[model samples]
Target chain A: MSTPIFANFHPDFYVERLWDKCIKCKRCIRECTYGVHIWDEKKKTLKEDHTKCVGCHRCSAMCPTNALIIRRHPSDFREHALWTPWFIKNIYKQADQGGVLLTSTGCALPYKNYFDHLVIDACQVTNPPIDPLREPMELRTFIGPKPEAVEVEEVNGRFRLKKKLPPVIRIEVPIMFAGMSYGAISLHVHQGLARAARDLGTLYNTGEGGLHASLYEYGANTIVQCASGRFGLHIDYLNAGVAIEIKIGQGAKPGIGGHLPGEKVTEEISKTRMIPVGSDALSPAPHHDIYSIEDLRGLIFALKEATEYKKLVFVKIAAVHNVAAIASGIVRAGADAVVIDGLKGGTGASPTMFRDNIGIPIELAISAVDKRLREEGIRHRTSIIASGGIRCSADVVKAIALGADAVYIGTAALIACGCTMCQRCHTGKCPWGIATNNPELMKRLPPEVAYEKIYNLVKGWAHEIKEMLGAMGINSIESLKGNRDKLRAVGLTREEMEILEVKHAGE
Target chain B: MPLELEVTPFHYSQVNKIIREHISKGEREFVLRGVNGHRYLFAGVSAEVSAVIYGTPGLDLGAFMRGPVIRVFGSVQDGAGNTMDHGKIIVHGMAGDVIGYAMRGGKIHIFGDVGYRVGIHMKAYMDKVPVIIIGGKAGDFLGEYMAGGIIILLGMNTIYPERPIAGLFLGTGMHGGAIYIRGKVRENQLGLGLKPYALDSDDEKLLESYLKEYCDDFGLDISEILKEDFIKIIPYTHRPYGKLYAY
Candidate 1:
C-alpha cells in the first residue's frame, strides 16, 4: 500500500468495550459509518479502532446491550497547562497541510457567560406576584419600528389617527427561531422550524439559502434573508415572505464569507440556491455594490420597493467591537428591525480561528447598542433582536431585561430536534441527521416529530417567561423590554456593571 | 386609455401611493408630470401598466417592479431599476450610479451615460434573463459580481471616444454573465477572474437583438452601432474559489 498523505497525530476519542457483555453481536460494526469498529473474522471477534471515532456515540446508542462507551482520549504528551492538547493538535493539523483549520458550531473556549453573572429581581411587599394560573399574564410581542409620535388629523369634525406605522410581526412568545439556511441543514429541519413558527404564531428565518417552493405556504411566518450570495433571489422569492432580512454578517464567522462545498451541492440544493449541481456556492465577504452606508440604504430601499412596503425589513449584523455604531447606521438606513448576533452564535460551518477568536458576547453588545440608540433619541425607530448563545428561558429573560425586544435561539432549537452539538457540521455525515444533506441520514429526523418537539420546547420556555414576568409583577412583556433596572450584576467589575447599565447585587 | 396624475410638490411616498391606488383600481396607463426627484415611483407594482414621466425622477425608480412599462422623458437619479424582477424601464437621458443594482429579471435601456457600479450583482435564472443596454459610456466597476444576465455598452454618443467604453476594473468578480463592449478593452482594466473572448456567432446574434430594441426606442441607427467590433468579457469559471479549501 502507498504511504498516507497526512499523518494521524492523535485520536480525539477512545472507545471502551465490555468483553463479557459484547457477545460479538457485530452491532457496532454495522452501525458505525466512520469504520471505528471492525470484524476480525480470523479471530471471530470484534476489534475497536479508536483512531477513527469522532465520539458521536452512534454505535453505543444502537447497541442492544450496555457494552460500548466512548470518552475523550487521555493526553499522552508531556503535560503543560498553557500548551493544551487541543492547541498542540491544532498546530500539528496546520503543520501537516498548511491550510486554515475549519470547525463548526459556536465558540469552544471557556469564556465567562455574562448571563450567569446577571440576576433577576422579584417583587416583595411594594408589588405582589400575580399567579399565572389564575391571572392573565401576557407574553404577546410585536416586533417592528414603533412610531416616535402618533399623528392625528381632524376629518369631518372627528379626530382620526394618521400615523403610517411600519408593519409589525406578532409572536405569541418573545422567543423566535433564528435563521438557519436550507443547505446547511436538511429540509426536514426547515419544515419543522416553519411548522413551529406557524403554529406558535412566530417567525422563522430562511437563512440566505432561498425559500423552497414547498415552503411558500408558510410565507406568513417566514422571513427570507438576502445575503451576499444573492442566491435564488427572484420576484416570487421576494414576494413569498412576511419580512426580508439583509444579512450583513453572521456572529459565528464575523468578517468572513461562507463556502458550501461542491460535494454538498446536490441537485435539490442546487435548485433552491439556483446554481449548478456540482459547483461550489461562494457568498463573498461583502456585497460588491455596497461600499458605504449609502449603498446599504439603497439595498434596503430596493427590497422595500420590490415588496411594495408591505413587509418589514431587518438588517442582521455580527456584534463586533463597534456594533453600537453599526446598529445606529442600520436604524438610520430605514430598516424596520436590527438583529445583533453575539460571538457565541452557532453556524453550520466556520473556520476554527474565527469561531473561537472573534466578536463580543451578546449581553455587552445588546446593552451598549440599546444605550447608544436611546442616547441618539432613535430607540423607537427600530426593533432589536438578540441572538447567539441563548440556552434556556433564564437567558431569554435576562436578554429582555437587559434590552432585547426578542431572542433568537438556533442551537437550543437544534438540541430540541435531537442535536448533540458534535461540532462536525462541515463533515456532511452528521450522526444525528440534524446538519447533513444525505437523504438516508436526513430521513432519520421526521418533520412531524421534530415539529412537535420544537413546539413543546418553545411553549415550555414561553410559560417560564410568563412566570418570570408575573413574579416581577409585570402584566405584559412590553414592560420587561429594556427594563435594566429590574436586573443586577454579581461578581462583576464596576466597569462591567456600568456598561451593562445595571447595579451591583446587595448594593 | 391612460390615466393622468400630476405630482408637483415631489413626495416619493405619495407618488407611489397614487400609483399603487390607481393600479389597484384598474388604471393601467398613467401620465405623471412634474416628477422632480420622487424616489421609488412605481415600486413593486405588479400590474401591466404603462407610465410616462416628464421631469427627472428620484432614486430607485421602477425598483422591484413587475410587469409594468415605465418610460422616463428626463434623466433619473441613482439606483434605477434596483432589484427589479420583471418589467421594462426606458430612460431617455443620462442615469446615475449603481444603476440596475442586483436586478434579477427585466430590461433597463438607458440612452446616455451611467455612473459607477452599473449592473452590479445582476443575476438570471432559468428562462428569466435580465438585460441592460446602455447607449453611452459607463463608469468604473461595471458588471461587478454579476452572476448572470447580459450587459451591452454601446459607445454611440460617447463624448470621449478615445477613452474606453467603460472605466477601470470592469467585470470585477463576474461569474456567470457576459458583457459586450463596442470598443477595445485593455487587459489592465479587466478585474480578476475575467477574460475577454472573441465574439462568437451566438454573442453577435444576442448583441444584435438587444441593440435592435435599444435603437428602435432611442431612434438610433442599429446598423451603424453594430458596425464596430465588440469584445466579450466572461468569468473564467462559474466556481471562482473552488480550490480555496482543503477537505
Candidate 2:
C-alpha cells in the first residue's frame, strides 16, 4: 500500500494534554460566537487558537460534562532587562489605577483598521455651505406615533384644528440613552442619566433592571424596560414611563442571559428587583411569553392596554447576521420604533468572548435594516435607533446619514459620568463606583457632578452635529437619514459596498 | 355585588384583566363566576379587593394580588397568586406549579395537591406575615429560598400512602420564614437542601387559623383536616445566602 501522500496534515496549534480536563465535548465549539474552536477528529481532541479566543466564557457555562474551564491565555516572553514588559506592565497599571482601557471597534487588540482608514469630504466650492455660528442649524427630530393620513378643512366662523392623525411625537435632538439596567450600573448612574435627560430635553432608559421606587418621580422623562427576568416589574413600573422598551437582545451580549451574580444582590438591590437578597438575578435571553412576530404584537398591545396606550413601545435588538430580517419583523410586530445595537456595543459585564466577536458592525447593520424597511415600504412606519460604538459626534452624524432616526448612547454616557472603563465591572470593584452596587462604591457617583458631565457631553455633541449638518448643506436631520446617495464607501469589498449601498468615491 | 358569569371556550372572557384594572382604589366586595380557562384574571389588583373564581382559570390567575381574597372553584393553572402582597387565595381544586411565588403578605389555601415552588421567596413586612396551607402532597422546592412568612403543609390524607409528601430542595435557601408540612414524611425521601423538624404547638396554632379559613372557603370539615399531624419549615435567617454580587 502506498504511504499517505501527506501524513503531517495536523493543525499547527493544538491544546496540550495539561488542559486535558476538556472532554472534547465540542461545547466550546458550539457555544463560541467567534468561531474560534475546531474539532480534530483524528486526535479526538479540540484545537483552539489562542489568537482567536475573545475570552467570552460562554463555553464555560454550557460545558455539561464539567470538563472545560475558561481563563486568560498565559503569555511567556524572553526575559529582557531592557524596556521589555514595560508596555504590558503599563497596561496593567492603567487598570489598577482605574483608567480607561481605550479601545477601538469591538475587540481591543488590533485587527484591521476600517473606520480610521476612511475619510469624509467637505464641500468648499459649488455648495454654498451655511456657517454653524451664523446660520440656522436643525436638530429637531420626532420618534413616536405619526398620523396615517392628514386632512385639512376651513370653517366658516373659525379655523379647523386640522386633525393631524400622526401619533408620533418629535424630539429636539436625535439622541437618547440606551439600556443599562439598574443592577448592571449603580442607582447614582441612573439618577445622573435621568437628570441629564431632563436637562438636555432627551429621554433616559431604565433598561431591564426594573425601576427603583426612588426614581419614579422622573416618569415623564424615563423609558422603562421589560426584559426576560421581569425584575421589579409591577403595575406602577409599567405606568411610570413615557415609553416602554422591550429588550430582545443586546449588541454586546446577544442571545445570552444578563447574569447579575449573587455577590451584587445587596439589600437595596434586592428590594429594587423584588427578588430575595443574595440570589443571582438571571435575565433570560428570550422572553418566554413571546415566541414569534405575532406574539410580539400581543405583548405590544398588552403594554398598550396596561398603560392605556399613553406611552410608545420600542423594541431593542442586537445587530446580528440577519438583523435586517429581524428589523422588518419588529416593524410588523407593531412597535413604534426599533433600536439596533451593533456588536461593538458595551456591557457592564458580559462574557468577554461574546462582547468582542459576536454580531455585526453598527454601520452595516443600521444601513441594512434601514434599506430593508424602506424597500418593504415600511420605512415610514417605524423609527430606527442605532447604537453600539457611537463614540463621537462624527459617528453619530454618520449613523444618522446611514439611516438611523436617532442613536442611544451607553458606554459613552458612563464615560461622561466618570467611568474609566477599567474592565473590572464584572468584579464590582469600580473605583469610580459607577457600575458597582456596593453602598460605599455607589456613593462615589454623586448625582450633581455626573449630571453636569453628561449635560456637557450632549451639548457639545449637539453643537457638533449641527455644524456637520450645515457643512454638508443639509437643512434638517430628517432630510439626512437614509440619504446614502450623499455618502461613499472607501476601500470596502464588493459585497460590503453593495450591503452599505454606498458608491465608491468619484465613481 | 355578587356577579355570576359563565365562560366557554369561545366566550373570550378576561374578568381578571377587566375587573382588576377597572376597580377603583379602596373598592372591595366582588363575586365572579363562570371563569373557565381565562388567563391573567385579577392580575395586579391591590389589597382590599375580594373576588371569587367559580371555575377553572388559565395561567397566572390572581397574580400580584394584594389585600384581596380570591377563591378558585376549580383547579388553577400555573403560577396562581404569584407575587401577591396581602390577601387570601383559596383553591378548592388542585393547584398548578409555582403557586404563591414571591408572595409577601396574605395566605393561600389549597384543598387538593400542589405543584413545585410553593411559597418560594415568600417574605413578610411589618405586622404582615404571609401563610400558605396545602391539603395534599407538594412538589419539590417547597418554600425554596423563602425569606419570611409561614407555610403549612397539612397532609389531610389519612390512609398514609407510600408516596413522599413533599419533593426535593425544601427551604433550600430559606432565610427567615416558617414552613409546616404535616402528616407522615418518609425519612429517606426528605431529600436535599432542607432541614426538616417536627412542628411545635405554637406552629400548629399559627396554622389553625389558616386551616379554618381553608375549610370555610371550600366548606370542608376543619376538625377532620386539623386531626392530622403537621410539619413546620422555617427559613434559617433573613439573608440566607448572604449578599449577592449582582444588584
Among all candidates shown, the one with the greatest DockQ: 1
Candidate 2 per-residue lDDT, tens place, A1-507, comes to 944322122221232223646666686776554456788899887776644443445455457766655454345447786645535444444544433232212344343333443345456889977677887778888896465555667899776658855466466778898888887788888988888888787889998777887788888778898876666666678778888898888887889756665567778777766655666666656664466897687567556544555788999899999999999999898899999998888887665557777788888888899899888988888999999888888888878878899999988998897664545565555556677788876776788878888889999999988887887887688878877776776777778778777777777
Best by lDDT: 1
DockQ of each: 0.33, 0.08
- The collision pairs in model 1 are none
Instruction: Give a tens-digit lDDT track for model 2, residues B164-194.
Output: 7887777776666677776655544443334
| Candidate 2 wrongly placed segments (more than 4 Å) | A1-127, A151-170, A276-278, A285-299, A328-331, A375-381, B2-22, B25-27, B32-43, B53-68, B72-212, B221-247
- Name the regions of candidate 1 deviating beyond 4 angstroms: A1-7, A15-53, A63-68, A95-98, A123-128, A149-167, A257-259, A288-295, B160-162
Q: Chain A structural similarity (TM-score) per candidate?
A: 0.96, 0.78
lDDT agreement with native, every candidate: 0.85, 0.71
Q: In candidate 2 chain A, what residue range of length 10 has the lowest lDDT sum? A: A5-14
